[model samples]
Target: MTTAEAETGDTLTEALTEVLSGARARGGLFHRAVLAPPWAVRVQDGAPLSLACMLRGDGWVLHPAAPQPVRIAPGDVVVLCGPTPYVLADDPATEPGLLIQPGDCCTTPDGTDMCEKLALGVRTWGRDADDPTVLLSGNYQLYGDLSTRLLDTLPPVLVLREGEWDAAVLPLVATEVVKDAPGQQLVLDRLLDLLLVSVLRAWFARPQAQPPAWYRAQSDPVVGVALRLLHEHPGHGWTVASLAAEAGVSRAGLARRFTGLVGEPPMTYLARRRIDLAARLLREPDATLASVARRVGYADGFALSTAFKRLRGMSPAAYRAEHGAR
Candidate 1:
């Protein structure tokens, strides 16, 4: 076996796959926007994530914190880390006359619901149906604390220009999004995930890009294997010595290396991961605390509750109630 393979037993692509496995779109809101000049939309949906692709013409993304508006040319894709409001316009000066709220709620300046009133067609909306400025967008709610690990790494607004990477999926995404047919939601959901994964892969491949700490640890021969073992078998009772033996490293060596790279001790990191997994499981309507506890390596509900509350500052029950309301 190659040296790196002997240690980590996985490639960077495989690492990314393991991480993105949880990102599935369930009834995600998608729309095709065709707008003429003097157009802008204020998106304040408070979703965990959103993706926008410029299919034709040009536009700008205006964020409250940004000193300048970022330009989007045709075929460019943008990943928005949201819960923060932002505006899209033909020009920076064109103010938004409409507000897009949660649950696909759209309102005019006078607070009138215009969701169906402005429906151009199936999953299409805009001032003019034939407008040259076309944008396709998908809003996704990245439920569960597990997604927070991935989401924490992204900036509020990240644009992947066409020149930066080949947007091969753009054509398929554009075509699939507007279709009104059977199993369309499933098709769109898969397409959305594919497009997102492609965009993220391209972005991370950039020379100047910075990925999450856990992601960066994938390159380490020792820590990578340890992390993979922990992630793959989170339910396992992994002590430092056990993990070290499995990784073909001494316990002290593994401890120092893992802490330096992953920013936490082995068992501490495992505990956090377990709780994160538990938090995700608690989001499921049918999952009881005890079941989630066993799934994440805790002996029972009390043990799980202690760890979950200690780390997350909220009880599992409270976390479930809050997310259930969402």
Candidate 2:
């Protein structure tokens, strides 16, 4: 491989690693649920992603838009992507007795708090003492733009059957859920992150899986080099000529290949990526617009604001106000 090709490969790997690590354990919510028969809970929309694992017994996931309810057996891992509501129950026909709203606050249909009343133990909640069905759920409440690229590629619902993937961390997550030790929340958060990464990696490896364009484009010898440079150094003042030189190709050649493979010109992709990084940095409470702009290759906050608004339809301040880190 040429120097550019090797650098591109390493850059792609590093980018993937950074995204996975950055997306993890950011105020994530987890709960171990033990439910009896005749129980159903409505999960509201707006959560970026949720993971449901059936530890014992079987259950059904009812998506309103889905033609039928998805039945999950013990050891099955289900990933539900949002802005879509879904229901979990012992049977598909059962009416939802409770609703799990954003922030994991549970309430009855009449708006009565059900969280404390049904609390079973440390990090555990349930309806009945003799319940047979046990489930573990982790909710990732990521901001809309934080991991938009990765989240946009997922289906509304994804299921992994037992033995289909190596999820040894599931057992550890279960074991650690009930612990009341110090930093237990952080421990569980990291474990959930591990499980998510493992499951997604397995899912993408399937032969029939349709990976996203950005992912597939990394294999292109020409576009890959340009993408690596854009991602690895978004703060650089890059032009088509500089990028082509880095890729050992002509400006026109690099532009054509990049657009064909990545569905956008290199400059366009770079602008979007810079805005994405700026958005993430804006989430920090102390970060100023000037700092964010400088970090993302803009000459000043005004320049970044104009580009961010034209592309995202909102100013950086407004975006931070709406989806800033909580």
The global C-alpha lDDT for each of the candidates, from Candidate 1 onward, is: 0.83, 0.82
The TM-score values for the models, in the order shown, are 0.84, 0.84
Per residue, candidate 2 scores C-alpha lDDT tens digits across 214-276 of 777887877787887787799999999999999999999999888887788889889988887
User: Candidate 1 lDDT, tens digit per residue, 191-228?
Assistant: 87787778887888899998877788977878888988
What shift in Å separates residue 245 of candidate 2 from its native position after superposition?
5.0
Residue 227 in model 2: shift from native, Å?
1.1
| Error of model 1, residue 77, in angstroms | 0.4
Candidate 2 regions with alpha-carbon error over 4 angstroms: 1-12, 64-67, 144-146, 244-256, 282-288, 309-326
- Which residue ranges in model 1 land beyond 4 Å of their true spot? 5-11, 65-67, 240-257, 279-292, 305-326
